[model samples]
Target: MSDGVATVHLVRSPARTVWTAIALSGAFLLAGCGSQADLAKVNHPRTVVPAKVVQKPQPNTPPRPVEPVFAPERLRAVDPCALMDTQTLSAFGVPASSRAVALSDCGNYMKDGAGKRLSITLRLGQNVLISDTAKTTKLAGLTTVESTSTTTCFVKSVVQEGSVVLGIVAQVDYEGDSCDVGRRLNESAINRIRTNAPLRPQGNKGSLTSVDPCAIFSPVTATEVLGGTPSMTPYDLYRCNWRRDSLSFGIEFAENTDPKNSSANKKAEVVTIEGVTAYQRKDDSFGNSCKIEWLHKATTDGKGEVATVSVDNTKKGVDIDLCAKATTVAKALVPKLPKP
Candidate 1:
């Protein structure tokens, strides 16, 4: 949405002179047959061709649709750190640190004069659930949902509302009334996104943000694994859920420690998936489920860009090997992911 406007502004500024110069240059020409000779004038009438006029579309003439400010495809390229930088946060407190918490999130930490901690988190494609107590207001020409707890405040503005709903969220945690701080941060974040927000590096060949989680697993693959046709639902751009009667499958791409070395796993069973070393674990504590995880690549600071697949048959009465089912889905998924 913002890119289209930038392009139009660029063309309008310098393109007018180019077209006008072409038209005027063709209308007249100087010719001299000899030194100190008088200029020759054609007796015949000369026609001057005017530059083509570019007209802006009128309101009543099938108005051009305004694209959503933040759509899924566009959000994938947004850099979270650029949305809320040190300069943008300097007003609240001394900007202490800023780091990327996730692909779509950046967390900023600061300290007030009294040495109290203050934080603001900016996220793209944030999933926000509006409760009855939450109030709605307009921020940057978009409907914003505001809610607060004792120490934290949440402000969310929907960027795209439809089957796959998405929003931009600004959360603040402060010692004082966080709502006031949240309001200012939210407004600044929105304005930056609409105007001069930075973007991810172009042509990131193997970035998972460009992949669609829903397209990774097909309906036929779900049916073959679950023994019944499954309904596919995407939680966000990075996660998808497929459910049958008593069986379910899920896949997600997110940040984590190396699955083989993660302490959360009771025992990491070494396994190989599509030539990639992986780990599988069975967890009966929560339900009859098994998970298979592998490191897609190292992102930053010992964090692994990982893909995890889970199979749950807790609802089924019979003793079905959940690990085998998880392996099947993992095999189908690993081959499709782009190599880092």
Candidate 2:
């Protein structure tokens, strides 16, 4: 050993060796814990910054109000001639051929205050077949016109195969010099004629009234005596066909007859102007007089079988007096047969 220096020797034992290792680990663990605590404290003292706010951009102005694209005035001014031509061609069922003729233009037609126009055209075949073309400016007032002016053109070739007679007549009227208005009027008139023409029959064979005077006779001109337009009212005339074997009977009366006043009732009476004998009978139920007529004829021509009755009306035309004055003039006038 050297002077002032001490030399210590460590003895190796199992227990002491283990204890020494544990102490070294504990010290290292304590140092690590101390470092984590100091770091946490230091971070807690620092201030935190808030995130920035970003705003969305606003639209500069509200969207402008949308306007309707179509106006009624603009529609009214649109050229209708093209539309008319298209419709007419469609109706003809054929392409515009040289044989087809254009009678009038839109210029000569008239326009109403609403700027509506009318135009007309007529096409005919070799057999007098007629086809009418009407062009209208306004769709609303097409049916207002009574008549129209139409152009007539004859087709060199026959379009249809049938026995038909076609004739067209047109009358055009205009407020001004617009052909468009005239065309529309013509179209309306033609359409009406076409609809109404089909209703008229050439003969009265299947109709309610008899056309042959020998088959039937009108006691009086029912149409004239009735005194009203047939088109406006329901009053109509019908001929009663005569049958020698069957008895012909009818009931007639005044329109407004009052039974309380016999004089008024007498004034309003129905008389047979021709064909048969008539008489008035008082009906107790309605206090009215009912006029009835019956004709029984054995002869075929009804020469001696005819009778005439007259009805006289009061000054006011309210009361009528029906009298049955039978005359044998028809019988006397009938030709006598030669001795057998």
Candidate 3:
């Protein structure tokens, strides 16, 4: 100690200065053992810490893809009606006659003596993913749902392993339980699958799945038949209506029923359209003035593809007015049909 004024000291070391500069640069930082720091003396020391190393992050993995439910090759030739056994259909009041709509779908009208009825339509493989809400069922290792909206109800079963979806659509107009009807339809179809029913009976070539009735004619020919570019409403793969102004007509392919047996009620005559024999029948049953049926594909009992051309000439008698136009349309359509 000196006087009350105080004392001053200054010291500079090359080693200390170089070390301080290195520490400030911070090229490497780590924890180390240290004691104290004396500012007045040359005993200042720095605190040290362990080296902190950081690593760059990696990207996350992608999710696995969903497996497909079915194989295209195995199902390409399947007939929708083949899925339902005849016994099952008869149990549900399905007549020997089931209405075909396209290749893999058909309906049996549960009709009363009167014209009123509910329809149970069976479809194969049209829908893959169906969400179940109000009703669901498990049958034959498949998930089924009974989904209804006001007028119609559908019960669908998903066979995931086989990648096949069997659907049963029914109207609520029938007696007894609606779901029961749908379940019956689905169970019958599933049972047929278990037994491995043939895609089609032997010697049966299959349906005319390739026919587009509305597009069978040229624009010029259609204009002549329809009187203009016909407003077309297609009802699946088998039927379509072409309408223009006061004239309306439809083209349809009927399977399993021969027009020969069906022509009893109507005045019928065999007419030639494009060299193929077709029956021309006049009946107002469906407001169809003229109906001309020709063969398309075949089944049995003279049963096969019965293509029909129907025209609406409500006021005109069936003589030449409706029949002439009907014949014209039929002739144009015959050449475009897929081979039986």
Q: Judged by lDDT, which candidate is best?
A: 1
Backbone clash count, each prediction separately: 0, 20, 8
**Full candidate order by TM-score, most accurate first:** 1, 3, 2
Alpha-carbon shift of residue 169 in model 3 (angstroms) = 2.2
Off by over 4 Å in 1: 1-67, 203-205
The candidate with the higher TM-score, 1 or 2, is 1
The lDDT values for all models are: 0.60, 0.21, 0.47
Between candidates 1 and 3, the lDDT winner = 1
Query: What ranges in model 2 sit over 4 Å off?
Result: 1-190, 194-196, 200-312, 315-340
RMSD of 2: 50.9
lDDT assessment of candidate 2: 0.21
Q: What global local distance difference test value does model 1 have?
A: 0.60
Q: Which residue pairs of candidate 3 clash?
A: 30-49, 31-48, 31-49, 31-50, 32-48, 69-163, 297-305, 298-304
The estimated TM-scores of all candidates read: 0.75, 0.17, 0.49
Tens digit per residue, CA lDDT, model 1, 164-252: 34456677788875666666666666665565545676766676766667776767888989876676655445667677766777887
Worst 10 residues of 1 by lDDT: 19-28
